[model samples]
Target: MSAAYRFSVSIMPRDGILDPQGRAVEAALPELGAVNVHHVRVGRRVDLEVEAGTEAEAWTTVDRLAKELFANPLIESWQIESQPVTARMGPPK
Candidate 1:
């Protein structure tokens, strides 16, 4: 039987890649009294659910989507985390 799994993907710019948004945030932080902050990188988190027969299958599905549709391979990288969903913790009806 296929099980529901929750996946969290964190996408970020690859190291050494120029991140204008990150740089802007980093610069603004110091002005906001965060003087010790440095090398700040702004990234995005994607939360989703997948149905598959096994954890590996769920991971594969998310990994494929993250690589092909969610993240830019040339400039960004992504990490995936998964957790099986229990009946008691299922999504709202």
Candidate 2:
């Protein structure tokens, strides 16, 4: 049986890249009493599930998916974090 793995993809703009949304949020932080917040870069996390026989397989699947759909390699970068999903079976009813 294949195991289900949950993977999280974090997408962020590359260093020295211009992030207009991040800039806008940073500009508003001071007015909201978050003066200490600096260089606030905004990013996104996407969670996905894959069924595979091994961790390598799951990672490979997620890597391809992330590059194809989650991140734009030209201006942004992505990282994948994953864990196995545990399902507890109760006594047969």
Candidate of highest lDDT: 1
Per residue, candidate 2 scores C-alpha lDDT tens digits across 1-93 of 787777888999999999999999999998899999888789898887788998889899999988899999999999998754543233322
Query: Candidate 1 lDDT, tens digit per residue, 1-93?
Result: 987788889999999999999989987896799988888888888888887898889899999999999999999999997744542344574
Report the C-alpha displacement of residue 9, candidate 1, in angstroms.
Answer: 0.6
Model 1 misplacement above 4 A: 84-91
lDDT score, candidate 1:
0.85
Backbone clash total for model 1 is: 0
Off by over 4 Å in 2: 84-93
Per-candidate TM vs. native?
Answer: 0.88, 0.86
